[model samples]
Target: MIATPYLLYLGHSNDEIGIKTSRGLAVFRPDICVGEFRHDDCGLTLGLPRLDFAAARDAGARTLVLGIANAGGRLGNDLVEDALAAMEAGLDIASGLHQRLKDEPRLVAAAARLGRTLHDVRDPRPDIPVGTGRRRAGKRLLTVGTDCSVGKMYTTLCLARALQARGVKADFRATGQTGILIAGDGVPLDAVVADFISGAIEQISPDRTDGGWDLIEGQGSLFHPSFAGVSTGLLHGAQPDALVLCHDPMRRTMRGLPHYQPPRLDDCLEANLRAARLTNPQVRAVGIALNTSAMDAAQATDLCARTADMFGLPCSDPYRMGVDAMVDLLLAMDAPAATETI
Candidate 1:
């Protein structure tokens, strides 16, 4: 009798476990072509379509390994579902080979492997030096989201450019899961979140840069369920001088849909303000950035006005208003000597 090699079916393409599994499978079966199918905000579905059960049967791959993060937690549900779906699709899904990622607190170490080590790579605690005394000449601003993919990066980058254009020395950092890119200095996503709190503070503190540098920090969201990469957590760990909440107007009605929808101005503003208060109880002001992925000028402008009226904070279509104007609005809302210096 001849012995055959085993085949594994893994799911979830965003994090480390999935990456490692895919790489391992590719190494073992160089002939197999791997394909990734991702759904908007829904996560990824990975498969090996070319390799059939017959091949597996011939090769003795009758056993399959299913990868999962948390066995019973919300994150694990999708993995479990994928495994079941593969079985339903007639593949020999393995029963006991349910692999789970080790219960690590954060992804900092994983990120470091990707050359994105955060500041103080050794320490994963949230403790950090807070600037003492009064607020200095530079403006302190924070960018948060209603949920992930609400265009936080584009807005922050645009704001940075805008501040620089107006002669305001501006620096930006992200403190969420994705924020690891800045914290780890280009590390992988997993490792970045572990050390982001302390790394972000060290990166943004005036001591790290010249005077008059406008500092902006990025956050995922307070309510995001998966990964729980909330900006509110960052705010609690490292307090900022001011807060900016980025939101999508159509988040409620069109969520989980294939296409993007422009958010309603009033609804978006209200949701952002509520979420911001969850983090910064005393958020000095609020602002809105229209994600133009699904809207035109007239719709964006009308939504902007509704947001401005609802939140009493300056609003702009980030795609149209130019970054400089955003920075100017942020600067104008600064409260002198308002921060509790570290």
Candidate 2:
């Protein structure tokens, strides 16, 4: 099923992950959400009609999703207790953390005793082979970001929605937990072995005769010291024909890691293209998706215009712009005559 209701946990100290999941759930439409989560640090809608574990269990929420994406995968004291309590209530647990819930003895025992399942979203299949790019077929696009948490997943989701609204067939491929939860089914690229990362994408989006579009959600940035390798792997693995570069105007340094400065947008875009073309010779960047939530309307508009002019491609905030500027480019490259106007 495309839509499934579950209790999403947002109690982690990293409120940013909670906020991202909260926004994602707005599109996913969970049955009920709990905790204080918001995009901008300012105003947050406290699910004050809050539903605790007991309340959620009574309401028949059999599945509990740990939606927070913290830096260290260690289950902290706060989340540990909450997860146990939910498990005690006989609710199955789903987690997207690098630290697998199944590996935790308490949760594992609790699940066994209760006969419930622990869904570790990051668990990758063994023996996943290397990618050949020969599996690539149909229309495909990827959302590459300038830095971490710069709206690659959000941009990809919005692009999928926009494509569908235009009566085009498209699918949003998830490479992270929040995106996987929203997408219902997708492989977590980071969980797979380094050698098979691209292979995972190849498996997720093999050749398609239906002429459908695959919006591959990018993981890390090519400039990020810790995650640069992953970005290169995804680009080479997916072999997308089109690409969208995502950025946040407010971000100066890479998230959490300040010593490393974020690269200029043009440099990031150029590098991503250069790396991607190694896999698919026809690959090209179609547009830019800017995240300007911190900026006021006037500032956002001005920055977007400048970015568009600088890149000589359509620039938009997927939340506000809906990828309208680049959809025409994708459609033209995918199907010229049919999508000439739209």
Candidate 3:
């Protein structure tokens, strides 16, 4: 008898994947030979009969699709390889199933529930600033990721406070209005942006003799679902003069052990540059904040030096360099064109 071919949907979160299956979405667990489908958001993995591609084909399954998140470019190569291996083993699977199958009602419902739960739990909408246009005055913006749980918010909060302490007028704003604000307990994104813009205008009012800068921080990866409006919204609304990319430097291991290693300086620089160019072509300079998860002071210093040289931006240890240094560095960088008009 010919082996049966099956479709597999792969994702990172076990609970989330299980919910997808409950909503009639075809999903298979690599550990089990069964396929599962479901229709609810409650977190549970149910096993279905092992998929037989021959049977599926006999059942008129014209195409097999596999979906995955974080599968683009260099990041998702492993998922692609694994899916290919399953196909080679006669599973008759499709590649990048998540995108292909996302249109299904069950999948859409599950996503909606997840979004609502997140919004209800964190009330992210309240953080969005009200105004839709660029600020009328010069401001400094700082962006940080909301994912990785690597202390991005903590660093951002610290920097904001430090900047204030140094008599620099800056306001903290979430990168994207969706997930970052939803994950927090503060004002919505629109309100925050409005307040920040108002603050900028006040600081640089035409009647005033001196003007101040505005600081905005971003949240989540550029491609993260929760970060939908971050890049474009920030550029269109806040018009940041400079960008500060904060990242954790702990080497991610397959075994989940935190290991100390040289940072991916080139990759970070290129990624930030690409993000800035894609969002707003006017971003003038880039600064980096490195989080030392397990590195010693000497290692952190060396890493900082190497990163600065490679990226042509100041690199500093968030723990050691302090927010004052960061603010000073940002002010010294040339302002972007958007700032000139304000």
Candidate 4:
């Protein structure tokens, strides 16, 4: 595992979504995060103490987490220099970019000379087997979305916590970099080879008989042309018995692709269910989770109510509003049908 007590490196990020890795860690694993490191011109903050490499190390940080998520996922020359400096200040380096830190000659040489570790969190293990498609023993719920960055991680996390609070055994299975950092373990499905993506997910979440739930975090949308393959692989591998559709109503178009419009909620849900049925024919949608960050309190509440009525399923903003209704519905699934199945 990458060392903790992290000093999150934000670099010079100005886009809020681009800094999702740092934001996720700060919100979900705050105790392990020591401080934030950014250029003077950077305006983002995680509400943590600001410190340089030396100060962060002195404050007991063991690693510097490169927490930026740019479009290309490339490790720029400036970032490489910062990583070298962090190692000099007695800290290891960890990254989840598409570019591997271990492959960078400069970073590799510095790490070896300094006796520091380079954690390429996005790197997949080599021994993953092809998906067997056999039924597993535990209950699972996957959070799907209408588009990317619509809070699938957040919804899964909330449901896991809520289930645990109700005296049920539950675990959050991370699938992406942000989720991986938050849960401390997961397969970076997006980084895995196309043929092994499903296999990687199967390895990440295997059979269990605790009568509990494995809340598997999701990746891209089935409608997103850029990431549909990853999403389909995750869907089949999860074999989820239930699903929670996540959406961001404020987006008029798919994230990063303004040319393509977001799919209608009905269309997105049906498409995901059909794809998921390839593994678990009984898989049903449990609820709807919305990222209502753009809405006021009243608007969020009203939208949730209308959505619940529209779909005949419990709907709520998993962050601003508690997912108690969804959790309750999930637990009561053994009873008669509370909602329609696909």
Give the best candidate by lDDT: 4
**Sort by TM-score, best first: what order?**
4, 2, 1, 3
The top-ranked prediction according to TM-score is 4
Q: How do the residues 266-321 of candidate 1 rate in per-residue lDDT, one tens digit apiece?
A: 55435545544443444554466757557777888788877777667667766567
Supply candidate 3's per-residue lDDT for 315: 74
| TM-scores of all candidate predictions against the true structure | 0.49, 0.84, 0.46, 0.90
Q: Is candidate 1 or candidate 3 better by TM-score?
A: 1
Candidate with the larger lDDT of 2 and 3: 2
Over 191-281, each residue of candidate 4 has an lDDT whose tens digit, in order, gives 7889887888788888877678899999999999999999999999998889999999998999999999999999999999999998888
Q: Would you list the C-alpha lDDT of every candidate in the order shown?
A: 0.46, 0.77, 0.44, 0.89
Candidate 3 structure quality by residue, lDDT tens digits, 1-342 = 112223433333355532332222232113222353222332334345434444534443332333323423122444444433333333443222223323334433543543311122112233233443433445556464423344455456556667777786655544322222212223233333434533322222222114455555454444334443443344344445566667676635311223522235455445555555543456655567778757888898899888778777777766566655567776576544434442
- Clash pairs, candidate 2, are none
Q: Model 2, range 67-135, lDDT digits (tens) per residue?
A: 766668667766667788887876777777778887788888887888878878788656577887663
**Residue-level lDDT for 241 in candidate 3:** 55
What RMSD does each model have against the real structure?
13.1, 4.9, 16.5, 3.7
Candidate 2 yields a Cα-based lDDT of 0.77
